[model samples]
Target: MNVPTEHLLILSAILFAIGMGGFLLRRNMIVVLMSIELMLNAANLAFLAGARQHSAQAGHWVAEGPVMVTFVIAVAAVEAAVGLALVIAFYRRKQTVSLDRLSPTGATSKAN
Candidate 1:
C-alpha cells in the first residue's frame, strides 16, 4: 500500500521535534544519545518519504532511499558505540552520568 508523502513528512517532522526536545531537555548522557538516535531516525524517515515520492512519480520504486538509509544506520551504529563508550568512561571516572556534573576534561580544579 502506498502512503501519502505529506503524511510521511509530517510524521518525520513530529519525530524530529520530539527528539530535539528530548535531547535539549534531558540531563542524562544516555538519554541524550538516544535522543540523537531518534533524530537520525527521523531524518531517515524523511529520506524514505522523498524517495518514495520520487518513485511514485516515476511509476517504480527506487533503491536509493533504502541505500542511503542503510549508510546512515551504519553511521548511527558507530555513533552509538562511541557515545556509549564515552558515557561509560565518564561514569567510571565520575560515578554519575549527569551532564552538569561531568566536567569537560574530567579533572577537578583545586583553589590554592
Candidate 2:
C-alpha cells in the first residue's frame, strides 16, 4: 500500500513523544526500557517513511531504509536483552526496580 509520508512522520513523532515522556516520567526500570524500545520503533518508522518517499519519487527499488531497519532491529534486540539483564540484576541486589530507590551511582546503596 501507498501511505503518505507526512502521516507516517506524524505518527513517528507522536510515538517518539510518548516514549520520551514515559522514559522521563516513569520510575520503573522496566517501563523505562519499554519506552526506549518505543522510541526506537518510532525512529524505524521514520526511516521507512523516508525510504518509501524516496522510492516513489525515484521510481526504483531502494534498500537503504530496509537495510538500516534490519540493523536497528538487531541493535534494539541486543539493547533489550542487556537492559533486561541489568534490571534483573538490579532487582536482585536492591529488591526493587524503581529508579527513585537507586543511589546516585545507580546502586541501592554504597557498594563499599
Candidate 3:
C-alpha cells in the first residue's frame, strides 16, 4: 500500500523540529552533532517524499531527490569528521564538551 505524501511530509517536519530542539537545547558536542545529523536525515526524508509524489504523476521520474540526498550524506560525513576532530581538539584542551564553556573567540569561560 502506498503511503500518503502528506504523512511523509508531516513525519519529516516532526523529525526536523525534534532535531532543531536537540541542537539548540543540548550542551554536549556529541549530542549537537547527532542533532545536526538528525536534521539532515529529516531533510532527506522530505526529499524522498517529494520525489515519490512527483514520480507518481504521469510516469514522471524525479532522480534529483536521491542525488541531492547522496550529496547531503557526503557532506554530512565530512561535517561529522571535521566536527568530531574539532571536538576532540577542544576536549583535549579543555577536558569538557559544554557549549557554554567554549567561547566563539576561543577563550575558555571561567569555571563556576
Candidate 4:
C-alpha cells in the first residue's frame, strides 16, 4: 500500500484546523494550553511533509526538529506552571478562574 505526499499534507491541515478550533472554543486555561500544543505539533507535521516533498536536506533535519520543539515544550511547561500557580493564588483570593471574573482594576484586595 502506497500513500501520497498530498495525503500527508491534507492530514496535517486537518489536524491543524481541529487544534485551532479546540484552542478557540475551550475556555478552561489547561484545555486551551493543550490545544495550542496540538497546533504546534500539527505545524511540525506540515513542516516535515514539505521538507520531504522538496527533497531538501533540511527535511532530514526535520527529524531533528524535535530539539527545537522540545525547547518550546519546556517553555510551555514553565508557562503552564507559573500560570497555574497564578490561577491558584487568584482563586484563593477571588474564588474563580473564569476569564470574565479577572479584572486588572481593583479586583484584588490586600489581605490585612
Clashing pairs in 2: none
Evaluated against the true structure, the overall lDDT of model 4 is: 0.69
- lDDT per residue for candidate 4 within 1-112, as digits (tens), equals 2456788878888888998998888766667667777777777777666656655544444444555556656876787788788778867777766555666674564541
Q: RMSD of each candidate?
A: 2.2, 2.3, 1.3, 4.6
Query: Clashing residue pairs, candidate 4?
Result: none
lDDT of 3 at 24: 97
Top candidate, metric TM-score: 3
Q: Which is superior by lDDT, 2 or 4?
A: 2
Per-model lDDT: 0.92, 0.93, 0.93, 0.69
Model 1 residue 90 CA deviation (Å) reads 0.4
What range of 10 consecutive residues in model 3 has the weakest lDDT sum?
A: 103-112
Is candidate 1 or 2 superior in lDDT? Answer: 2
- Model 1 regions lying over 4 Å from their true place: 109-112
TM-score of each: 0.91, 0.92, 0.94, 0.62
* Cα misplacement distance, residue 105 of candidate 1 (Å): 4.2
Task: Show where candidate 4 strays beyond 4 Å.
Answer: 56-86, 104-112
RMSD of 2: 2.3
